[model samples]
Target chain A: MQMDKNSYKKYADARAKKSPCAKNCVCAFLFGGLICAIAQGLKELYMTFLKEDDAGTLVSVTLIFIAALLTGVGIFDRIAKHAGAGTLVPITGFSNAVASSALDAKGEGFVLGVGAKIFTIAGPVILYGITAGAIYGVIYYIVTLIMK
Target chain B: MENLIRIPKPVYILSSASVVGQHEKNGPLGEYFDIVGDKDDTFGCDTWEKSESEMQRLALSRALNYACMKDTDLEAILAGDLLNQCAGSSYGLVSFETPFLGLFGACSTAAEALLLSSLLCSSHMTRCAAVSSSHNASAERQFRYPLEYGGQRAPTAQWTVTGSAAFISTSCKDDFAQAAHNGEPVPVITEAVIGKSIDAGITDANNMGAAMAPAAADTLLRYFRESGMQPSDFDIIMTGDLGFEGSSILCDLTATEGLDISAVHCDGGLIIYNRETQDKHAGGSGCGCSAVVLAAQALRGIRTGQIANMLFIGTGALMNPTAIQQGASIPGIAHLIRITADIV
Candidate 1:
């Protein structure tokens, strides 16, 4: 039987299993919150030994290191599978994306493989992040100048 | 005149072998596979691509061994994989002395290869081997992401199966026909129907089942129309790499076509993994997913006198990273082959 694209999609959508958004959101909230709570605890502990700025920087470093290492050992993706946006919303996801790409490309060689592909997953985020920030900066600049 | 090309003579499945990785080995059809890979899923190769090639080699070698034939016995070998330039098949079959033909049917390579092999056997060649494979790590690196990438898999996303299988087909001339004459059941290829590529405006690469289901439905409808066969004529209708999502979509799509195939539909993707246990969200995919399942499960059933007749519909989504990025929707194809134990 012949079908237009719209009808085909309708048929597919009717049969295809829908992702449980409520369950996924709940899982993401709990896991993402837990990650933040850990970061908060780590910052408090680091604050005891160093300056506040240094401690904050160290927290970021620590999280990135743990995420990258966990990715290398192949534990991060497993958790991310269940955590969904929870693991991804945090700084850990960025590190996992980079580290995973680097590891994946190590076979082809350092230059073409690792260097070129290191940012493959995270490239869009960086590109859009910077572009959006610059646009927001122009808006802020124009508003502040008028205020002055 | 109908898309049906009835084989002038039967090309029976002589032997086949399956080799799989840790994930597949851990699944329900674990023991059915001929060979299982190492703990690292490397299959004794240093790289994922090489491991994939090695799987093809091992499976073909084992398949030939089971038939008590050498590489020299094959008139030609047809191999295909889901890699750029079909690297796995080209490199995998290099050592064999037989003439080689490389194919690229995405997940449908197994069936495509079989179609060619059957044609060759029915025409001139006495024996031909069809090898199809796919590796999860290699497929991931090429198509989606790194092996360790912490990206959450979509509910519609299918897990590329790490497996390979070789099917050896021989014309029913002398020795091959002996089993049938001796009153024993033999898996025989009766007819084949090549399908047209169909696009359903699906853009998500993860939901390949949706993209390919329409093509499968189109092919099934055409096969039914041309051959004058109903869904119940066959004991089962086996499909390649539709997984859970594709299988359901296929049923619904065909249902709309006024063909009720739900009662007899079995998909390679769904049978390979347990939904409750394996996190293969939708199910297993790739050329190997269907190839190995057909080699290990379906063939075994036919040999054991369980299945009388069956139809294999190899479904494939012909999309690449470049086209997907260029805003091109995935086009799909499904090739149909009728295999039967009953010569009548």
Candidate 2:
């Protein structure tokens, strides 16, 4: 059916009225800042709970790994729904994915099943990092050696 | 907040069509190429003319072709275009027996169609709805052309091609659900962040990337905050074409924001017409660029479980003579759609 211009404008206006918030605003900044704060809190908790000398340094890294793991298991996603990226952006999200995948396979047998499966999701991340690092390392070493 | 609403169902982008490269190959629109100076020998006529009725016929036919719909099915069309009165869409939709709705968002028209169609299906307003957009080369020519008949064109401005795209959204039935082995549908649109691209203080066509980049970054960052999701939560985060310049600028801006979500994002415009094959100076634009990619590639991947969850972002440059005359900057807008696979 042909919609008259007035009706069309009404629809367009209605659609615009229903659109999401303008991107630049105090709320966006405050909320986004809040997510960052929670992530920092998680890092501090990991450091104190682990009680390692390098705890502070390791906490952020560990949390990211844990978060990625939970993402794999599908549980970090639930946490994310509640905390937003405040929970997911940290290292714990990665760990959740690894742990979930391993747990899923625990019934099969520990050594071959659970132990081997932990890396299913984490493996790619590790592989890419190591490979990229190695390539960069080699390039650096070559440049240094040539200068010498 | 009362005005802003969200759709609860996944709307599949079934098919998209583009006349960008097609115009260069052969068409009545080919004659206009002489004015633009076939510099790279790869110019696609972005502008063309067809009677309002003719445009409607071609657009509807393209939409139907992609939908794979039969004459007897109970479906409806949600279509839009840039022309005054939306003649292209109205005429095209008239031929169909199905109910139809006409809409306009200037350049943001297609996403509006998709959003409205998804809402209709989620609320059970209809079982299936089709959304499409079209831009005629000749019609755009008359709009931009001078009264003197011939005018020198800026190298950076893109030609608008006539094209149409459509998708079918069907209800999730019990039997289909059982057979598919799906999860609770990922929220199709938990949140959306819309941004208007204010003229980033530039008018040169080469700087469109800069003009549209802020809008892209603004919507994406907002979506992340409101939805409480990290970049990694999504298997892929796709943006409608911003061309090469805009894509890089967007990436750079996101990085500067400390968001660090770059590993999984891509622009639809950069991928649509392979630069190697078509050798487009920048990349495809117009409504069909994103529509086609979502239907043919992104949605297919999601349905097959290739990606668990995806975020599709469509961007548009809000350019009008009034704004330009007022010396106001061009503003841009972006809308995000999140789609997840449901087996059942």
Interface root mean square deviation of every model, in Å? 1.3, 24.6
Instruction: Kindly list the per-residue Cα lDDT of model 1 for residues B1-344, writing each as its tens digit.
Output: 57887888889888889999999998999999999999998988888999999999999999988877889988999999999999998888899999999999999999998988999999988899999999999999999988888777778999999999999999855555432234457688889889788888998888999999988988898889889999999899999989888898889778877999999999999999988998899999999999999999998888888998999998899988999999898999999899998432
Q: Write the per-residue lDDT of candidate 2 for residues B1-344, one digit (tens) a residue.
A: 32234565544433333323354333322332211113322232232223333444454455445445542453567776666677667765676778777876544566666666777666765445444444434333324421111122222344343445556555444323322224433223333444544445544333344456667777777766666678998888887767776776677667777676678987766665555555354565666556655655676566566877887777766666556667665666676667765544
Clashes of each: 0, 49
TM-score of each: 0.95, 0.55
RMSD of each: 2.3, 25.1
**Top TM-score hit:** 1
Chain B fold agreement for model 2, TM-score: 0.74
What is the lDDT for B82 in model 1?
95
Specify the poorest-scoring 10-residue window by lDDT in model 2 chain B: B146-155
Docking class of 1: medium
Off by over 4 Å in 2: A1-148, B1-6, B9-76, B128-130, B139-143, B146-156, B159-161, B174-199, B276-279
Q: What's the distance in Å from true for residue A110, model 2?
A: 84
